[model samples]
Target: MKLLKVMLSAFIFYLSFIYGASAMAQDLSQQNKQLLANFANEVFVKKDLTNLQEYLHDDYIQHNPIVPQGLSGFKQFFADWFKAVPDWQYRLEKIVAEGDTVWAYGVYSGTQQGDWLGIPSTGKHYSIHAVDIFRIENGKLAEHWDVIDTYGLFKQLGVIQ
Candidate 1:
């Protein structure tokens, strides 16, 4: 009878352990989603790369069609873009995250205050819809893929002509 009680207690403990682990995983996933959202809004939209560095891995990979490469490439691109449009800001339309993957949809808009792609400043204000997918590992962004309306941007900047 004592052995039976011990076996039953072990079974209950095992079940509790499993349930506790599952709950912790769920909570971690939710926190990750919120972290991604905050990174996009506070870092990208706010153009605050100082705090952004903390959330990005050193080996970050970016798979943007225009600038396909590492995190350094993205940083360079942003630098040049910001030089031309210093006030560029993103307005997040939606964000959806599952597991370690996050998708962010937003509009990037700014006034052209400097030269871009050899085009002189037009002082034109433009907005382009953009979507970015990020993969996080160990709570840091490891990889990213982005799509933006480059054609529209070029058209607005009169660079295509």
Candidate 2:
């Protein structure tokens, strides 16, 4: 048997070069999960943080403990939560990425007349339930993890209970 047909054609050319390098690493992990969901839809639903180092990652790690770790404390905690909710909105039901991480499950409504985290003006609406996770390396957005609901946004601003 001609050397067993050259060892079964070198094991079928090494299994098609390992499935073509795992399908080119799954298309570069789905383009890094659509570039982190289009950079989280341009900074959380187009609030437009504008090119912050072309999508963060200048030591951007923050775990969201009242957010203050890097990237100017994540752009001053979303610039004081979008200047106390200047119609701030985020909806994302679910999103996920692989090898560089990227996860989201969202709903973040807003309409605060003024202060927050110090809790003051709850002039109108509120909606919480947010979850965020990001990692991404070479393409930026280095590290972040968040979970918002802050006790259902302080019980929908009734200040609690």
The parts of candidate 1 lying over 4 Å away from their true place are: 1-25
In model 2, which regions exceed 4 Å deviation? Answer: 7-13, 23-56, 59-70, 73-75, 82-92, 98-105, 115-122, 126-135, 138-140, 143-161
Clash totals for all models, in order? 0, 0
TM-score of each: 0.77, 0.36
Per-residue CA lDDT of model 1 for 54-130, tens digit only, reads 78877788776566366666677777888899889888898777778888889999999998766789899888998
lDDT values for all models: 0.82, 0.82
Q: Model 2 shows how many backbone clashes?
A: 0
Model 2: per-residue Cα lDDT at residue 35: 80
For all predictions, the C-alpha RMSD in Å is 3.6, 10.9
